[model samples]
Target: MVDIRPDWQLLIDGGKKDSDGDGQRAVVNPATGEEVATVQEGTAADVDHAVEAARNAFEEWSDTSSEERARRLYAIADRIDDHFDELAEIATLENGKPKNQSGNDVFTAVETFRYYAGATDKFYGDVVENSKDELKLKVFEPYGVVGVVIPWNWPPMHTADFISVALATGNTVVLKPAPQTPMSSIRMVELMLDVLPDGAVNVVPGGVEPGVALTNHEDVDMVAFTGHDVTGEAVMKSAAENINPVMLELGGKNAAIVFDDADLEKAVSGAILNAFYNSGQSCASIERLLLHEDIFDDFLAAFLPAIEELNVGEGMDPNSQVGPIIDEAQYDKIQSAIDGAVDGGAEIAAKAESPTDEHLAGGHWVPPTVLTNVDPSMPIMNEEVFGPVLSVTSFRNDDDAVEIANDVEYGLTGGIWTSNLERAHRVAARLETGMVGVNRPSFVSLGLPFGGYKRSGIGRKRDLTETMREYVRVKSIQIDHTDARYSLDLDLAEQRTY
Candidate 1:
C-alpha cells in the first residue's frame, strides 16, 4: 500500500507546508478495487491559508514579465515529460484508463503549456480613437486568485491544462481534483513547486466540502470548473452569490449525422471510435447517431459488427481496446443508463456482457454497448448518458438529420459524415453546436476555442489569445494630448467652450 501520512499538508507560498488537521480520505485504485493511499482533506481554514498565500504571492508574481512566466511554465512541462512513464502508470492505476490514453493525456497537458507559453505576450489590448489628440487605451490585468475544480474523467489532462494556462497568464491557481482521481494531480502540483512558487499553484484535496469552500471563498476572484451540469449549477449559484466571474465546461449530449453518400467504411470506424473512446466518458463523445434512411440499414449492419469486436479489459493489458469505467458509482450509472435505454423502446444491438472472474480480477470493467431503433424523443437521446452507450436513430434526409441533432438542449459538438461537399457545408450550417466535425470522429484542439451555446457550458476555453483574457480584466486609460502648443484643435476647443 502507498504511504498516506506524508501527503496531508498544503503547499503554501515559498514552499511552506501546513497541515489541515487529520481529516483523511482514501484513494482507491479503480482498476484494482482496493485503497492505494489516504490523503488529508483540506478544511475551510486550509483553503483560507492557501488563498492568502496566493493573494500574497500575486503582488510579485503578477509583476513578472510574461516571458519569465512562460519560461517557468516550460520548465514545469519539461519536468512532467521527464516522468511521463511513471505518471502514465499512476494515471492508469487511479483513472482505470488505457496506458496509451494516459500518455496521450500527458501530451495534451504538455501541449497546453506550449500553446499558452507562446500566447502570453500575444494578449494585447486595444486603442480607441474617440476624439483627436485623446488616446483611449485598454490594458489587461490578471485576476488575483483563480479557483479550478477539475472532474475525474480526465484528471491530469484537465487539471494540468487549466494549471498551465492560468499560471502562464499571471494568475495564481487553487485546484481541487475530483475525489476519485486526485493522486496524479497531487504529484503534478508537488513537482510544479520546483519551478513555480508553492502558493502560486495550491492543491487542496478533499471531497465536496473543500470544493464548496473554494467556490464560495470571497477572496477567489474567478472560478473555472469542468463537471456535470447539476454540480456546475451549484458552483455557478454559489459564485453568483459573490457575483464572481466563472468559466465552466459542463456536460454534453453530442450528436453525429451520417449521410447516404458517406463512405460506410469510414463512417462506421469513426462512429465506433467516437462513441467508445475513453469508454464514452468524454463530454465531446458523440452519443447520438442520426443516419439517413436511404442507408440506415447498411450503416447499422457495419456498425453493429464493429461493436461486437471491441476488446474490453484492464488499462494495462496490451490487447484491451476499451478500459474499465472510472469507479464503482460510474459503473453503476453506466449500467442504469443501458437498462433505461433498452426499456425506452430502444433495441440493444450489442451488449458487452459481464466479464468472467479472470477479466474482473482488477478494475471496474464495462464493454461497449450500442442501441438501435431509438426514437428522437427518448430519454436516451436527450440525456447525457456519459458511458459506452450510443443511441442510433434514422432520418429521412439531411434536414431531418440536422433537426434531430439540434433538438437537444446541448450545443457542444456534433459530427457530420458526408462525401458531398455542398451537403456537408449546408448541413453543418444548420446544426446549432459550437464545434462540428465533418467526416471525422473528434476535433478538440488546444488552440481552438472550446465551449457550448446553451446548457452545455458557459464561456470559452483554450482559444489562442482569448484564454488569457478569460483570466484577466481590462483597464481603460484615456490621455488628453490637446495641451500641446502646436495642437491644431487645442485653443479652438477652449475658445468654443468659453
Candidate 2:
C-alpha cells in the first residue's frame, strides 16, 4: 500500500499561503483502492480571506490590457503543459478516471485556456453608432470577483476551462472544488501560482461549509457552476438574496432519438458511448433513449450485446471500457435508481452484477446497466440518473420522437439520429433544449454556448464572447448634445416644432 499521509496540499491564496489544519479529507485512489493523501479543508473564514485577496488582485488585473491578459493566459497554459503528466497522475489518483482520459482531459483543459487566451486579444466591445458632438461609449469591464463551484465528475476539465475564461475576461476568482475531488484542483492552483498575478486566482477545497460560504460571500460578484440540477437550484436560491448573476451548466435527463431511416450501427455506437462514458456521470449523458417503433427491435439487437460485452475494470487498465463509479454514495444512488425503475415495472435489459474479484470488490464499481419497456412518465426517465444506466422507450414516428424528447423538464441537451438532413434539423429544432446533436451523440464544443432552458439550468458557458458579457454589466452613457440641439417637449409651454 502506498503511504498517503504527506504534507501535500495547501490553500492557494493569490500565490501564497499554505493554510493546513487538522480539518482534512482523505484522497482516495479509485483504481488501486487506497487513500492517497489527507488534504486540508478550508473554512468560511478562509473563504473571506481568499475573496479579499481576489478582490484586491482584481484592481490591477482588471486594468490590464486585453493583450497583456492574453499573454498571461498563454503563459499559464504553458505552465500547465509542463506539468501535464504530474497533473494527470493526480487526476487519475483522485478522480479514478483512466490515465489516458485524465491526460486527454488535461490537454483539453489547457487548449481551452489557450483558446480564451488568444480570444482575449481579438474580441472586445464594438463602437455603437451614437449622435455627434459628444462621444457616447460602451465598455466591457470585469466584475470584481467571481466564485466558481467546480463539480467532481470531470474536475480538471470543468474547473480549468472556467478559470481560463474567467481570468481571460479580467475577473479574479475564488474557486471551491467539490469535496470528493480536491487534490487535482489544488495541484491546478499550484500551477496557476507560477504564472498568475498574486491573488488573481484562489482555491479553497472542502465540503458544503466552504462551498456555501464561498457562494454567499459578500465580495463574490458572480457565480459559475457545473453540477446537478438540485444543487444548481440551491445556488440560484442563494444568489437570489443578492441578485448575483450566475452561469449554470446543470443536469440533464437527455434522450437520443433514433429514427427508422437512421443507420442502426451508427446510432447504436453513439448511444452506447454517450450513455456510459465517464461512468455515465456526464451531465449530457443520454439516459433516456427514444427509439422508432419500426427499428426498435433492430436497435436493441445491436445495442444489448455491445453493452453486455463492455469490459468493466479499473480505470487505469487500458483495456477497461467501463470504470468504477466515483464513490460509494454515487454507487448507492445508481443502485437506488435502478431499483426504482425495476419497481416501476421497467424491464431490466442487462443489470450490473457485483464483482467477485478481491481487487474490484472494495472500490465503487458497477457494470453497465440497461433497462427497456420504460414509460416516459416514469421517475427514472424523468429524473437525471448520473450513472452507468440507460433507460429506453419506443416512439412511432418523427412526431412521437419529438413529443418524447421534449417530455422531460430538464432540457440541457438531446440527440437525433437520422440520415435525412431535413428531418434531423426539423426534429432538433423542435426539442426545447439549449443544445442538440443530429447523427452525433456528443455536442460539447469549445466555442458554442452551453446551458439549459428549464429546470436544468439558466445562463450558459463556453461562448467566450457571450461569457464575457455575463461577467460585465452595461453602463449607458447619454450625451447632453441632443438636449441642447432640441429643447424638451414634455410640457406644452416648452414644446418646440423644428
lDDT (CA) for every model shown?
A: 0.82, 0.81
How does each model score on TM-score?
A: 0.93, 0.94
TM-score of 2: 0.94
lDDT of 2 by residue, 31-124 (tens): 5567878777888878888888898889889888889988888888888888888877777778877777788888988898889898887656
Clashing residue pairs in candidate 1 are: 31-363
**Candidate 2: regions farther than 4 A off:** 1-5, 16-21, 351-356, 479-498
Task: Give model 2's clash tally.
Answer: 1
Show the lowest summed lDDT stretch of 10 residues, model 1: 1-10
- Determine the C-alpha RMSD for candidate 1 after optimal superposition of all C-alphas: 3.3
**Per-residue lDDT over 378-438 for candidate 1, one digit per residue giving the tens place of the 0 to 100 score:** 8888999888999888899877888899999888998989989898888878888878888
lDDT of candidate model 2 versus the reference: 0.81
Candidate 1 residue 54 Cα shift, in angstroms, is: 1.0
**Highest lDDT, which number?**
1
